[model samples]
Target: MPQPTPLPAAWPALPTELDGVAVTPADRARYPYLSSSYMRVGTPDLILMARDVDDAAAAVGYAAGLRAAVGQVPFSVRSGGHGISGASTNDGGVVLDLSALNRVEVLGADLVRVQAGAIWGDVAAELSGHGLVITSGNMGDTGVGGLATAGGIGYFVRAHGLTLDLIRRATIVTADGAVHVVDAEHEPDLFWALRGGGTQAGVVVDLDLEARRIGEDDVVVIHQASQQIVDDLPGYVHAWGDLMRGAPREFTSFLMLQRLPDGRHLSVARNVWADTDIAAAQPAVSDFARLAPLVQHDASLMPYSGIVPTPRSPKVGQQHIQMRDALVDVADRALGERVAEALRHDVASLVELRSLGGIVADLPAPATAFGHRHQEVLVSLWAQPRGIAAIDRAWEPVEAVASGVYSAYTSDTRARQAELAWPGETGRRLRAISERVDPALLFDAGLTLRASAE
Candidate 1:
């Protein structure tokens, strides 16, 4: 494989000052540490922390001019730095960090504008005060920039749809350094692309999202654990899937596997239902509780904000972490056995099965860059760094059992994973859009761009 050329060191045509821009070694060090996701291996050549959108635009313009002059274009703008593929960092190029541009303004009780640098936690907190909330990622630390653009999924997804569904408008800085406001009425094509397009299109400075008022006090969250893997696991999954198929719009669930302190394994299932009839939703989740004695159950009504707890960062010292994902319609008994068998090999290995139906599957393909609109469930397999050989040995059995990959859960560098996520025509369309917006192929480093284009 050929190595990518490094970006130039000096800028000949850049202005002396860029609207209160700051570029120091400390700033560069901070940029390297800006990644929020688990993958943190690269460092940017230069860091330009912009104070505002003008400053951001100016910084981008300077980088573009320098790229044209030195025949080396930069990768992309990074906000919240959650890209799992390391797209936020460049080998020897400028990284336009938007973290400093965090700002939020409520247009009214029903709408607000958020800077790309802000995380979903801050947004939710600010909106909750006004009795309004926007659909956002389940993880509070996830940035609104990447999540909204990549089709935000969360606890509220069963009701309000993806995060992009709430977006009313956005201010984007195009590759040509021109700033444009996009919405359903204006620049509709660009708006369509931005919904689920990822960061390949451009840098979104600000996003205007529609907000809704729900019964925050009516939220019900339940967490239960299964002690043993029984033959009834598949039956429980099928029953849950059937319930979800007919579930009210206000209910959502996440089923995960966690390692117990005694070196034993347990399956933890969490369900959040906001309907008026809590007793009715209980029967849907009762089988799992029956399968194993309840470990900890919190089924009482609480505030909507209370349901979304603070997200914990990835554990340290776990290098060489590899994740595999799949979307399945039915959880087979044989597959469950294989998963249990794989878990016996290592302590850190986990199988996270998230129920996906209702609003998630009803959305149109072009609604956002999220292509898996028809997937019923998303299964993610993750392994920590025991060693490269250990990861290979543990992941092989799980990989063999999975049917397909989920785009969001899989790493961005895996092109094969993207192919499994998007399949044929959908993958081609996303690639074509990437080429059109980024003709010079500047944003191709860490993202799952077309391998042939590279």
Candidate 2:
């Protein structure tokens, strides 16, 4: 096993002035445990569990003071701790655990204020009682802060838009420890970064999101397509894109490849229809039903909240999975075949291509940090276990055909590959923003700017 890195000797002394705050080793252990996505294996130097926004501000103040002296600061705000790349953890640094700050306020029938620490499942369940559901992560275990900031893609994306698109306002604590409310009218630049830039700019404490009413009449269409149709999957995907171009705003669909319990590969199509009669929505999905024999088709009316699943605690020795994201104007049938061929060799490998038109493409590029506005499809490749060889083999074929990649889905080892993911001017702008916010080259775990030869 590799030895963990040691903390710097000049690291700032843990603040003892915090009221109602605990900084014991056991408390720090709890911080690492809050990470539902993955485990760091190594413990952090300290864990500050904040009860409110002021407590969070104090934590950031301590880190900022440490950076002033040490010339760098390594820390993260852990909310639901669902950062797939383990961006919320550092080998030797402070971790501000915001899970205790979970709170939700329903401002109106169409709006709500959610604390950063709240889980999406909990938020969805609360909102469902009022006949409201905001566009959130597909998995219920995702944190509000991480998902909202990192560009949320969920079942409702086709109908409503990404989670950030539904956000009306946000409260963030900056590098200087000042807490500010940001929206279209206030601190707009930081607000722009907060939407998609995620924790890169600051720790978002609260967010006000635009909610839509989705009742029990809403239908979640789920269908299973077999491996045999994998050759024809791209054509079906293109057809779905064409359908989206003409479909009503109430309908949205995405594709997924899952390894069944029996070790056989299965493709799933999840279609969400809001307010549209199932009879009316059936025609749009007719092309998918025609491509292959369906293993299971459960398209029925249900509450939007019913679709999200509760998250389990992080398991020990969980394999590190490498994920890659890309935007495509059209699904390349050749690339789909190549991915299918790769999966045949490695049963655990998978590829998911989702239609991305509807409301997603209508949003302007500068509307949020999520840059792939004009894309018609979103492609993602995943490989489990931490080995370099396995991940590289799984990604090679897909990378060959992908046009642009999503920065959030990438791995720490492939940080340099970000240049390839968000290429040219976009990559340069992200690097420049990283330099301005984290100039000392701290927070260099997953993706951070390093001095380049100019």
Candidate 3:
């Protein structure tokens, strides 16, 4: 009898019969769970859990072949497994699990190379020794590949631009079954689309990211339990947006109103930055506190990684029903109040507004696939409204003052979801590029513009 490879301390021993890739029903008993999105439930016919870049390429080849045989097939790749949209998994397709390839290596003091499957929390610990930081999602458990390609918005948001902005290079497995290393100069078109459009072109195996040097001692967090949006929900965005614009680039804030487990809703505000001299930074922090009716405010120096909430393991298969309206807007006060009122009365969910602009808007919209660069605030509403009627009412005010929407926040497979995510000229650009790079259409275009948007 041959022996199976000893499992990692965290994972169970793999069945000897199961190699790197596992098929359904065969591996189903031990490894049925895979993905973190709540929008859909699917049992993939094939699950290519790769052990390395070579394995990932082989999996991509298999999916490409299957997709080629049957037109418009569903195939997906999951990394940190925290994809908010249901695109992480498919009804009956392949899921290329990249977690096994997790590796983090510092190229030097200021650049880091990360495998696609690794989570940011692991990367943070790896980079902490170098006194370096990279802008990523607010959650430490976020996957590097998904967030990086989808345009990461994080604690260091206003301080640096989007995460994709710092990408130095990447190794992606194209449909031709070969790993192509791309950067600004190499395969620049594919690289440009990958910056914010996601895996429509290929599966990124690993990436080189530019790291900003900052130590644990330089990080600071400003927390305040200020006015509840409930008091003046309509007045929230304009006040917060005005504050975000006037505040120093060193500071970033998130305005949220969420329901507690006790069924009470409280508005919350949080600010983070990495800097020396708290006293020098005090006056600017005070400006944000006075924006709404102040309740409490505190400042403390912490680690760069400390800005993200403590990493929590996601519960697989435990789907939370949520409808999100993620938009970019200047946030008209009167319109914001209407949105707030709608949220307060109809939805039992939370609403979040993150500060945008600063370096994020400095680049031209054509610089990357992310086009809503002009907007100063991100309005995200997570709710389960009564029905189409209630949802329509809740979205009206938000859409009124918004420039455009982000596909990541909403997972519904609408007929024109692509059109909504990237509208007009931007959508046309993505469509044309997608056709050029992904002639097979094997890659999922859920996050891009609709192809038939004539």
Q: Pick the candidate with the highest TM-score.
A: 3
Ranking by lDDT: 3, 2, 1
Candidate 2 at 190: error in angstroms? 0.6
Listed per model in order, the count of residue pairs whose N, CA or C atoms clash below 3 Å is 2, 0, 1
Residue 310 shift from truth in candidate 3, angstroms: 4.7
Best by lDDT: 3
Greater TM-score among 2 and 3 belongs to 3
> Can you write out model 1's per-residue Cα lDDT over 101-152, one digit (the tens) per residue?
6687889767889999887777777776676777775666667777787766
Error of 1 at 427 (Å): 2.7
Per-residue alpha-carbon lDDT of candidate 3 for residues 1-454, written as tens digits (9 for 90 to 100): 6544332233333334345466553554545565334345556655667888878877777667665655555778788777776677776566778877789998876889999888888887778767778888677887888888878888778888888889989998876668888999998877877777777667888999998877443333443335542455556566766777777777778777764445444677767754555775687677766666655556676666676754546536455655555556565576467456556545536678888888888888778766668778777777673565566576666656566666556644454545555666666676677787667777763554533232
lDDT of candidate 2? 0.67
Off by over 4 Å in 1: 1-14, 26-38, 71-76, 216-236, 259-264, 275-280, 285-288, 311-320, 332-338, 341-348, 386-405, 451-454
The lDDT per prediction is: 0.63, 0.67, 0.69
TM-score of 1: 0.83
Error of 2 at 372 (Å): 1.0
